[model samples]
Target: MKQHLKRTAEYRISNRRMSKSGIASLSHFLYIRQNSLFDIRCWTFDVRRSLISFSILPG
Candidate 1:
């Protein structure tokens, strides 16, 4: 990955507490930069999974 991509990934990782939609947006932005190297839609899939899992688990 390029320096900018690495930086963006770092930023996205740092926003772990952000909303799923926000996370997807950031991931999509990074995906576009990667020239389709990363599948952001798939990333959002994982995010949705996490959301569902979180909703199922006890608080």
Candidate 2:
């Protein structure tokens, strides 16, 4: 009975640690995703601006 209780306590502790790390990793992924989206938006805007300038220029 005592061994079973000890094992149960250890399991709960490990579960909490695992969940905390999981949250941290999820937030990290979201941060990277947001940065990538921002970079894509900037790149697209630059491309559009260059295209417009090229069209405006005389041959």
Candidate 3:
């Protein structure tokens, strides 16, 4: 009856909240992962450039 309806509403609200938080956390994780990958790419590029310069200087 009324109590059952109330319980159902509460359950739905909680489920919606959980899904929102889950999406937020997932996007946060992806953002961090993307930044880390970009950093790694930059680091690798810098290292390769330095190596080329060093080799040219020796020659």
At residue 36, candidate 1 shows an lDDT of 60
Write the residue-wise lDDT of candidate 2 on 1-59 in tens digits. 99999999999999999999999999999999999999999999999999999999965
Question: Which scores greater on TM-score, model 1 or model 2?
Answer: 2
User: Which of the two, 1 or 3, has more lDDT?
Assistant: 3
Q: Which candidate's lDDT is highest?
A: 3
Q: Which run of 10 residues does model 3 get worst, by summed lDDT?
A: 49-58
What's the C-alpha lDDT at position 7 in model 3? 100
Question: How accurate locally is residue 48 in candidate 2, as Cα lDDT from 0 to 100?
Answer: 100
Name the regions of candidate 1 deviating beyond 4 angstroms.
1-38
The TM-score leader among the candidates is 2
TM-score of 3: 0.83
Model 1 Cα RMSD, Å? 19.5
Ranking by TM-score: 2, 3, 1
lDDT of each: 0.83, 0.98, 1.00
State the weakest 10-residue window (summed lDDT) of model 1: 35-44
For residues 17-37, what per-residue lDDT tens digits would candidate 3 score against the true structure? Answer: 999999999999999999999
User: Candidate 2 clashing pairs?
Assistant: none
